[model samples]
Target: MADGLLVFDGYCGFCTRSVGWARALDRRGRVEMRPYQEPGVPESIGTDAATCADAVQFRGPDGVRHGGAAAVNALLDTVTGTRVPTTVYRATAGLQERVYRWVADHRGRFPGMTPYCESHPSECAAST
Candidate 1:
């Protein structure tokens, strides 16, 4: 199988949790969650390291690079319940970019998706 690599910010709590959800949603196992900082991953995938730091990125086996929510849409295309949103993205090109950029800019503050440390301060003690 040609697994798609979904790269995200490892240090971000929201990104971490979001990725955990993505993994669960990826029932077909078409996606692999990877931290952008992982050694050789960025180089091997040939994605723009700087841009990936801003938002999620997915590198398909076909050598195409999809970033931001477009990347998310593509990565989750086969997963259940994502077809509509993905189609909306395809229908409206710039919409995904704006939404993805906004979310990326404010990822650290989104409710429920907040850094685990913020909600679980006590648990963070060990890691700190």
Candidate 2:
């Protein structure tokens, strides 16, 4: 059985690229990924498009869902055998949100499929 699911935007070049990188680095094989837009997802997990519309989402050890940079940090900890120091991770949390927004805002320049849950698939699909 998989340890937990990382629900990600499969269509995003950045998300796919990052997952690939993490998979390579994850010697423990503790994490697995599912595209958030996939039909297999439980509505209880994402709820609505906007709530899980970020660059990344992860269901953690306790099965609680997490998103954005927190998900990324949790992945790092799961792979590295130690938690990322909270002081360092939280210190930049605010800035991380801004950066994530920027990436979400300009996802078109990304070189792969549209983000999995593009609010404007018409606009986003045109780019793909």
Top-lDDT candidate index: 1
Which stretches in model 2 have alpha-carbon errors above 4 Å? 42-46, 85-87, 111-128
The TM-score values for the models, in the order shown, are: 0.77, 0.73
Q: How many clashing pairs per prediction, in order?
A: 0, 0
Which runs in model 1 stand beyond 4 Å of their true positions? 78-85, 112-128
Q: Write the per-residue lDDT of candidate 1 for residues 1-128, one digit (tens) a residue.
A: 64678877766787889887988887888777777666555676786557668778888656687888888887777455457767877898697799778888998787545554454454332332
Cα distance off (Å), candidate 2, residue 44: 6.1
Compared with the true structure, model 1 gives a TM-score of 0.77
Span of ten consecutive residues with least summed lDDT in model 1: 119-128
Best by TM-score: 1
How many clashes show up in model 2?
A: 0
Per-residue CA lDDT of model 2 for 38-107, tens digit only, reads: 6545354645445555557777676777777777777677666677633456889888778867877776
